[model samples]
Target: MEILESKEQKLFARNLICVGIDKCENGDFCGRIWEPYDDQPFKFTGINEMVIHMDDLYDEWNYPQRALNERSFLRTHEMARTNIIRDDGFVEKIDRLQKMRGEIGTFIVQVKFRQHATWQGVVVWAEENKRGNFRSAMELVHLIDHAINKGLLIK
Candidate 1:
């Protein structure tokens, strides 16, 4: 496990994002991405599309679960009552790690710092057991893209 130096840093663990690549025929990942609160993982066909989804998750995870639920209160009473969702199970699944890994490729992204509206963190290419640090969201994408295209280390 990675060690971070600040009190707020511990919170990053729950917000980690997992990407499981089901297809990479065109050199871009095509698979499902999971966030801590999602009842189900989301499917995407390309890196650009996946990044968009991840960005949304990044925004949502920045808030406390209670704050997220309170935001739901802004919806109409019926909608709010019906839309209550708990991420406890989702959190457990990710904590176990790679139970959601895909057949082709898998990445566990830990976005430790969110400054200048971008991410700075480490990504683990789980299949090859390789790790790399990224200074921005784009860097993370490129790191994964490069690994997929150049070929992962053969086990």
Candidate 2:
């Protein structure tokens, strides 16, 4: 994770924003890494084209039978409510991270890219340095901003 730390240090040097993150009940400060795209095409793309309905969204995040080695918990939305909406700094912190990532869509892409690169422990750097060959992050931000302006809100 040294490379990730170094990147965060450079970001701090440039924007004075530290990469300090709070422990999330489910995932990132605002939501799961996929939460932003939960109501979008990306969700289906990741889940073998399964359309997530409202009923499925409301399902509990409980464990299976509450075994001795496992523990039950709240639903995804409930966790989001507690860890994101209930956290006063969640929105700002998420926005800042998005900015650090260059944009929300860019952030999503980077997350997936990391996932594909390392399979797990996404914080780990890839072996090959395919730097400066990716698509423009600002272009994606513009598209996302346009969609948001057109009354986009959680499908």
Candidate 3:
């Protein structure tokens, strides 16, 4: 995986979405992926579709952890890539290959996939300098749910 410098300009120019793989120090394949949204200048709504490879499934039960270090579980499987959607108007595609490599000896996991697998997570960011006074992550989650049901995340 390549660490693309997430600059302010680049983030603003193109819709920025990130995918990461989590694993133990050992060389064990734990199928897991993460997608995050940081729409600074624009107010993003949600994601489109998250697609992942199917061959990476190891019995479909034993898999990597999908939740991030923050303990936010998307309620998806580990072997199968998951997708999350927001309500605003932004979409991010996630996959195993796009996972970020661990830093120098920092005790991290590696992301690998025999085939191309992808998943989409929808996210909504604040509008450009528009403070709606929206508080609480639950509120944001509700908004995302609404967007998903409305089919607004689709391209």
Candidate 4:
């Protein structure tokens, strides 16, 4: 329920990445979001950046029946396959985000919820004024790098 500035959202949009999970026949496997810990702000991370297990967090909300409809699902999957730079950029940014987090404070990351019936797409959310700043984009990238290196994204 947090309203982020268009600038921040744009930065986030540039930073966000989505990946496709083929195993999900009905729905799609989007990317992930991480916060330092519970009660902390949420940040978006791309699909390639983390190896997520669909079973771990996959649920009714992420894979709703409406998202499974033939047309919408196909479009979502197609988008995932075609978007390459967005995917690669996500990986690169993650590396930078994590590194910055280490220098600033202790934190945990989690998946941000987009909406029901959006296939694998995820929306970034944060506590009001609690979200990271433009200067922290590098740190956000670093956090992603660490998650990838640690295999935290792997399911």
Task: Give the best candidate by lDDT.
Answer: 1
Candidate 4: regions farther than 4 A off:
1-87, 102-104, 115-155
lDDT of 2 by residue, 1-155 (tens): 11122232111111111111112223222212223212222222221121122112212222111122212385334322122223344454444443423122222222112122121112211111111112232332232233323323112
- Which ranges in model 2 have alpha carbons more than 4 Å from their true place? 1-84, 100-155
- TM-score-superior candidate, 3 or 4: 4
Sorting all predicted structures by TM-score, with the top scorer first, yields 1, 4, 2, 3
lDDT of 4 by residue, 4-79 (tens): 2222321232223322112211222223333212123223243333333221223322322232432433443422
Q: Write the per-residue lDDT of candidate 1 for residues 1-155, one digit (tens) a residue.
A: 22111221122366677788888766567898876555588999988898777765655454222222223345733222212123445546556555568778788888777666567777777766667778777888777776676653222
Model 3, which residues run further than 4 Å from truth?
Answer: 1-134, 151-155
Enumerate residue pairs that collide in model 1: none
Better of 1 and 4 by TM-score: 1
* lDDT per model vs. reference: 0.64, 0.23, 0.24, 0.29
Off by over 4 Å in 1: 1-12, 25-27, 63-91, 152-155
Ranking by lDDT: 1, 4, 3, 2
- Each prediction's Cα RMSD? 8.0, 18.1, 18.5, 16.1
